[model samples]
Target: MVFTREKTLDRAELEAYWKEAPATLEGHPIKVLSGYGPHEVWEGESTEGVVIAEFPSMEAARAWYHSPAYQKAREHRVKGAVYRGILVEGTTPQD
Candidate 1:
């Protein structure tokens, strides 16, 4: 998921969201490829933070996002920052 925050209305709320997010993925396999740092936009515009998480499958990713715990945590994000997010299926290269 990629998020672009146009404005941060509440830092405390955003922090709370992050604090609660990890518990939601307790049993799910997740890999963080990149995020939570400064980045240079080589092409189009970008947000303050960019996160890429690799899950076992698309379904798992979807479940995690839709789970009740996450749903609650998401409320904080909604109130914290102006953002845009998306989920894209990845492709595996074949020989």
Candidate 2:
């Protein structure tokens, strides 16, 4: 999943979401590829920050996103900042 921050964040809500979200990853094989940090946009509209995460499969990703724990955390994130999130399946390279 790729999430692009769209506006200033509510620090309190963001903090809360972060705190709760990590705990929810206990059973999922989710790996964070890129986190919110300094980024240079090559083209198109600019965004404040971006976060990229990878899951083993689409089913796993959906399970994580819709899980109760994550859903609870997502509420705080939604309140904190607007984001454009995209979930795309990646192709595996042939060995």
Candidate 3:
């Protein structure tokens, strides 16, 4: 699932958040594959930060979000901005 938070955060603080993210998600059930933000595109589509993660399972993904490591990461994100988040099920092929 991808999460987005609008332009509530300043550049410096957002950068700090980005810096702390990768290591924190390591060995977790949910893997953050990629994250990105618009580089001041000057478009009215809303400037926001985006995150994409891969989860082992929906339950595992939720668990990771509530875990202590993510909690720590959340602190910085909250300070930086306000966000809207969601989770979507991943596709799998049966054997």
Cα lDDT tens digits for candidate 1, 1-95? 55566578899999998899888878877787776667777886666777778887889888888889889999999998887777878877899
lDDT of 2 at 36: 92
Best-fitting candidate, measured by lDDT? 2
lDDT of 3 by residue, 13-53 (tens): 66677788767667776666767734454666774667778
The candidate scoring highest on TM-score is: 2
Native-structure RMSD, model 1: 2.2
**How high is the lDDT of residue 11 in model 2?**
83
Clashing pairs in 3: none
Candidate 1: segments with Cα more than 4 A from true spot: 92-95
Task: Give the TM-score ranking, best first.
Answer: 2, 1, 3
Relative to the true structure, candidate 3 reaches a TM of 0.70
Residue 89 displacement (Å), model 3: 2.3
Candidate 1 global CA lDDT score:
0.81
Q: Alpha-carbon error at 83 in model 2, in Å?
A: 0.6
Off by over 4 Å in 2: 92-95
Worst 10-residue lDDT window, candidate 3: 37-46
